[model samples]
Target: MTQVDKASRKPCIALMGEFSAGKSTLANLLIGSDPLPVQVIATQLPPVWISHGDAPAFRVDLDGNQFAIDLDNLAEAPLDETAYIKIFCDEELLLQCDLLDMPGISDPNMSSEVWQRMISKADGVLWCSHATQAWRQSEAAVWASLPPDLYQRSLLLLTRIDKITSERDRQKLIRRVRAETEGLFLQCLPISLLQATAEQDDYDVWLKSGAEDFAKHLVDLLHSLSEDGAVGPEGQSLPEAAKPLRISGLVAPDSAPAPPPAPAPQTAAPQIMPRRVRLSPSPQDRACARDGAPGRPS
Candidate 1:
């Protein structure tokens, strides 16, 4: 099937994972608001394509027909005939890129076609795996099966890292996953989505949650995709050497000590970081980020 016209579209990043692995949570976190209800997110719904706007919610069927639907009653959308649900949000982050929240790869009640059919619509992915059982065999097999071009630009995020109480065990788990999927992903990072989303105003808590590093890497990745010619027009393929992007100040997973906290921006920055993620003020010449507060100057 033909995907969106890349020549005129923003980069699309897919949120993928097994059921309850924080895919919905990550989506909510990124959008800075919940576009779908928790109950609706938990159901076996199709991919939700979110963009930056106030357009009403709608559904796209397998036959490529469009049907307007009430966002509050997403559960009522016929799953058997739907290809994806389109929801437009006004978050500034959506201005930079689009987010496609996919179904859990491991849902027993859902068919692979539900998500597989939407993969081609993505430019990259944020693969969420539960920290307690990060990177299961099934997940790895599925990830391995994806086109190398797609996987190369994606990041494997170990969601709910806060659940792994022991620092030692957390480090060990990250090490193991990184080694096993060494070259399969751009990077494998651990994060506590709950903490990052809950403690938006507290900078230290947000940084400790690993949201800072993840945000930096994510911004860098998106910038590269847009500026480095990583994503081409409709019919073109990704470049072979477009794998690594410069992630300034990003610490290794095994030794990702939180950087020393800097003072919060004097003013809210652009919404580059997640709704909760705020960076310290940097030189005015450097790129500005979210909440009217700019990110650290490059």
Candidate 2:
């Protein structure tokens, strides 16, 4: 790949949502590990973590010194002065993509400046809201302030989808939230992060939580971003070509291969087709080929 192509290949997706929007849960699901600390109680601190080899989670202070973390307790760790903590995991799927599991956007205890600085480093965002009370005006208003570049790459996820018992309620929230966000998001998917975790063994859970659709959507979005050449709001090129889902580091090494048998395999091989090309010499090559004009300045 050319340098320009290589520059466009790095895929980074940031998860931004209100407190306890299952942001950590979603990350766990995608990574196939609950190793990430998740709880209803607000242990809200910026864990600027990413996945790779099963490296240790180190406390990275402002000076960039690395200290081992307890994983059970990050609260005691200082965040205001610390640069960020990096958690390395065996999940190879993250190699191609870097995930920024950011803290809540409008937390009273934590200043916006904390998350805002991280936002500047994101390539795209996954904004999760609780399905029970989704797409709140506060969420919309905050999302509105995001620049158009962010808007184009952002996706809204209505988490805790199983909370809505009735199908009527599901459709209602879907339509309602869709209307509110409209064109702001590339896609908005309703997911039951809880159910998804519970039925991790069951194939139905993936579809039920809407992760199946969400995964497909994410693949398309990541590919589009790669092709569009807009890595961030700054319009820097993204790194080499990749289908986000198939990325090496984002998923676990021993993760199960997908169940077989589709009318057409979803992981279809790229089709090659013959095409026409002009073999004629250009003005720049006139000295060699004479531009194919009879005796023209050979």
Candidate 3:
């Protein structure tokens, strides 16, 4: 396929969830490096459209105008008037799919319009709900409005599963979310974004952190999108010119096939650990916490 065709065909997977749902953390983990500014600054900006390339950053205004931007000074980009900031990188995972790091759905400081406007660009969604507060009413209400076709393509992630601590609580939380979002998502997985991103050098830690299983399913989903004609937000088919490409470092060497149908609720629950819950700003959060930028509401 030609370069332009390949770019158009690359499946765009949006990372969405409430504020502090670890969406940014997951983005950094998948990309194998943090390309955007720290979360403090990032959460305030428009949807960051990340794709596979080496081109410098630029902002796409609401009028479809493209203006050169300096990543170091991303704060200067007017969030109110911009459509989305396009960030290009050469990450391997990005070669197979474009990851749109969307702002929190319920961000009080930012309007819903910011993310709503970009929904049309997504082929699928990786919705990250906090394990402690999985599937809130607001989240459910918003998700209910999404295209029905996307329900089968979307994956609901109960992030920060490690925070639940007890196995019983973890199982209960998973079961509850599963029941509440039945048929609304392809599958639900409990994961610790912090653990997954921190255990890069240790294969065992990486697998145990739930990244392995997540990666396997994600790759399979991308492959499926490439083969099938998944429709975009506008009810138009997304581009499908390129063949499926293997992501090098994200999936484990011996990753199992997409997790088998989840076992019956009474069976031994999956041994996925809950994620860390930080009341204070994390190092990353603190990095952008300077200048009294509005903090992400819990």
Best by TM-score: 1
Candidate 1 has a TM-score of 0.77
Estimate, for each residue in 1-298, the C-alpha lDDT of model 3 and write its tens digit: 2334434466789999998887876776666566776644543778888887899999999999999999866767887899999988786567667899898898889899999998878788999999998999999999998878788888999998888899899999889999999999988998887776455445576566776567656766786776564443333554443333333324332223335565657766666543221111111211000011112222
Alpha-carbon runs more than 4 Å astray in model 2? 1-9, 37-41, 61-72, 200-205, 228-298
Shift of residue 156 alpha carbon in model 3, Å? 0.6
- Arranged by lDDT, best first: 1, 3, 2
Which stretches of candidate 3 lie above 4 Å from their native place? 1-8, 39-43, 200-204, 229-298
TM-score for each model: 0.77, 0.70, 0.75
A best-first ranking of the candidates according to their TM-score comes to: 1, 3, 2
Models, CA RMSD each:
8.3, 16.3, 13.4
Candidate 1, residues 221-286: lDDT per residue as tens digits? 787667644343342544444323322122122123456556668796544342222322211112
Q: Judged by lDDT against the true structure, how good is candidate 3?
A: 0.71
For candidate 1, the lDDT comes to 0.72
Which is better, 2 or 3, measured by lDDT?
Answer: 3
Clashes of each: 11, 17, 7
lDDT at residue 32 of model 1 (Cα atoms): 58
